[model samples]
Target: MLFQNVIKHCRHYTAPVSAICKPSDVFTNLSNEFPYYLPKIIKTSLTKKKYEDNIEIKERIKNLSEYHTLAREPIQGKLTFLAFDALAESKDLTEEKLHQVQVLAWAVELVQSYFIIGDDMEDNSETRCGKPTWHLLPDVGLLAINDASMLRSFIYEMLKNNFDQNTSTKVENYVNEAFLTINIGQYMDIMMSKSKDFNKFTVEQYNFLNDHKSSFYTVKLPILLALELCNKVSQDSYENVNKICTDLGILLQMQNDVMDYIDRDSAPVKTSSDIQKKKCSWPAVTALQHFNEEQRREFMNCYGRWESEKVERVRELYKEINLPHLYRLEEQRINKTVLEKIKKLPDNATPSADFFYKIFDFIHQYTEDISPSILKSNVSMSAI
Candidate 1:
């Protein structure tokens, strides 16, 4: 039924252009366009909770449910929307906010789908969310790359279809900027793992990487997309929101890093992904920052290698250095700052504040004590 719904929408646009659009061209274009429809359908079928405002936002969230299915191996249609519905609801919905909400909800799903698919391949991960990963399916390995690309393209299609041409262009610029920023962050993440000069990385570098990689898509782009869609952008608001979201993003990733050290069951990938890859995650960098020379040498020796003992050693070192406590302290400070900034927003700008605070609450729940096993799980468990 979900696929049929998407096919129906694809037919609406494809039939008229069939004469001009090549058969292959139509199929390919429609394939990209169809994914957007899936998210909407999935959200509707999965979500039953009643919201007081922004029914349209709910509708848009329904659109976002498609990605979970797309990201999974057996790829059941029913399970697709389960993850994103929660994320959509986390942002208070409103009629005026529907388009932006839907766009962002769809964008987050698209971004996650792309990253996880590619990450599966890069990490050689065999399974995801208790199922085979996209790259692990028979004949799906390298094709996952193309699938990821299509996921990225679908974000643009959704933007263009929902907004006027002018707003679409701005949205395109915003997506492109975020895309490039995340790519840079990904590159830094990969490079940090490979570099022998692990000592060269500072806490500032860790912050920079997380801000660009995690923050851009997770916080900065979503809020900015919402504001821009509402024509709410201004020099002051833009600067202020950007700073706030960036800080939030770094704190979120730092929490993620801390979770890696503490929560063993929830973390999806191998514990060694960060260490084996020699990733310069927050905990590692912070340990380096605070640890004395002898402790630092022990950290360097234990990290950047794949031995189980070394990994255990690194974990012990984190506890010994009280990195978790430091992480909690930073999270509180950043969260307070984010809240203060939200409170300062002009009354007319309440939607942005509402949307932002909703996300902050959502992130706070998952990242506070337990490390979320997979980011998608938060979306799944919280669906409507």
Candidate 2:
């Protein structure tokens, strides 16, 4: 119901259907061109390794495309195109300009693929989108590390191929900033998980983790790229749109932290690893604050442990404190708050406010139309 109520009073979404790129179109373009940088990457693998006789490595290079060709919602690409398309309405974007947007959008997905592959390994995650993660595939254990790096290398290659020298340099700054922030955030996350010290698992720390680790790169980067292309980087609207991106990033990650604890059928759960892994997630932080002394002892005892009985104790404590219901209330408040913030962005200005509103519209459709019973993994990926 909070999901339904959210964005209800936000501006009525009025972006023209003809003016925007569809998710299906983004997906088609991404899948069609995903292999663009593979040959070059494989050539490097073959030449650099000097492993022509190594059948296992040779086979990996031959089949590298399949690792990246996985079908996805491509929310980042879609958002990038929407932001670019929104700006286009003011001054018509040429076909070449639109093509450049597509190239960057493609690169965003490559970044995402790298994150998923590497994060899964780091978290010891077993499945993704209902399939075993890349590292779990035959003969891919530690080599998947190189595979993930290979995926990341394509992003720079795409940028170099598509943008002018000055523009390429500018975009590289954005890429470097995003990569560094996410890496630091991830390091903090893994450190906290390993320690399992409730003193360090404060809400303030969780907010830091959420903003840097998942939100900035997921929400902020694509929007920044679009603004960069529009030459709106110098305008005040840049910071205005950025604040909104930050808010939505907070909201998006809160959804992930809460959803991690929600019970579900065996299939389709991307992971409940957050609990067993002792992630300093939202629910854990919230519950820690409200817990009594005995409760705190019990929680710290059960949390972050792998055994089923300990995991069950965490579940029981969550139910006793009504964490799921508390999350619903908090979500409703944040959802309304973020949508109202988006509404305040000037529609007639440099970066159209309509873009952010329409981005929420896409999220609205995904939440309402797709997988109502349980929000799909895409919900965790992003929409804002």
Candidate 3:
């Protein structure tokens, strides 16, 4: 029924089909370009190292490539590259610079894949990118864990190989710092999920979680890294640009949280794993504010259970609280505030700002459209 309602509403949602760059398009271009950076696996038997099992390493990279190039959905690895694209479009970049950007873009995607594998294992997720998560595969069980590490190491290797010594050092340090930030954010997120105490979930905590966990890696780091590569960062307002990027990251993460409940395409189940796990996601946190004491008590009784009826009840409660409508309103408010900030940005920052606008527009088509009421009334039509 939830899926049906989403379908019913999505038919009315509209955005320009021409101007928008599809995630699939980005992924396709990235995939075609990714292999150029991947080293040809060594086939010789004479190799000496303490931990490097050549055969296993080859298999891992092979699997990584296969996992990334999934025919149906492939990894949406291009999310990071949007920033790179934005920077490149801001000026006419040379082929050599373009290749450097592509390598770094692939590095960002590799980081994403590395974390996704670990996150799925931690969440006990069944699927990712429309396929069984790498860890869940028949041959990959626990080996996927090591493969994730390999993926991460591959990033540094790529950086060292492709970049000048000084540039590589800075880039590596930036990525390492981002990894630390995301790990801290992940720790807080895990702790919150384990606690299951909604009292601890506040707007401040939400912003912190999203900022460190999702913002840096998803938006800010990519833009910062690409701008460094483009030599455009020093000319712009770094703090202001970072503020817009972080705010957009929170909005994107909220959209992801909402989709977990409403989109069946994410996993095999009709119900959300976040609801089942009792994670204090944006929707759950927002929906809690609308419930009366009695209703709140009743809601908690089924908040993290594994029953179909309980999940349905939770959905009904969400609808009763008009969360779908309120979510649309919040989205519009955030978008408006962000666009205003972008408009006020200094001239040097405008191109990057426009790039952000374009990326958000492309993402909103999927993230916001899945909400039934949001899609139906067309209440938040974002110009592309």
Which candidate achieves the best lDDT against the true structure?
Answer: 2
Please provide, for model 3 over 44-150, each residue's C-alpha lDDT reduced to its tens digit, 9 standing for 90 to 100.
Answer: 11133343466666666756854643322211235445656665543535566666766676666566667777878888887654467778888889998888887
User: How does each model score on lDDT?
Assistant: 0.57, 0.67, 0.63
Candidate 2: the clashing residue pairs are none
Q: Candidate 2, residues 274-298: lDDT per residue as tens digits?
A: 7898888888988998788998899
Where model 1 places Cα greater than 4 Å from the true spot, the runs are: 1-100, 266-272, 340-362, 371-384
Clashing pairs in 3: none
Candidate 2, residue 97: CA error in Å?
Answer: 2.5
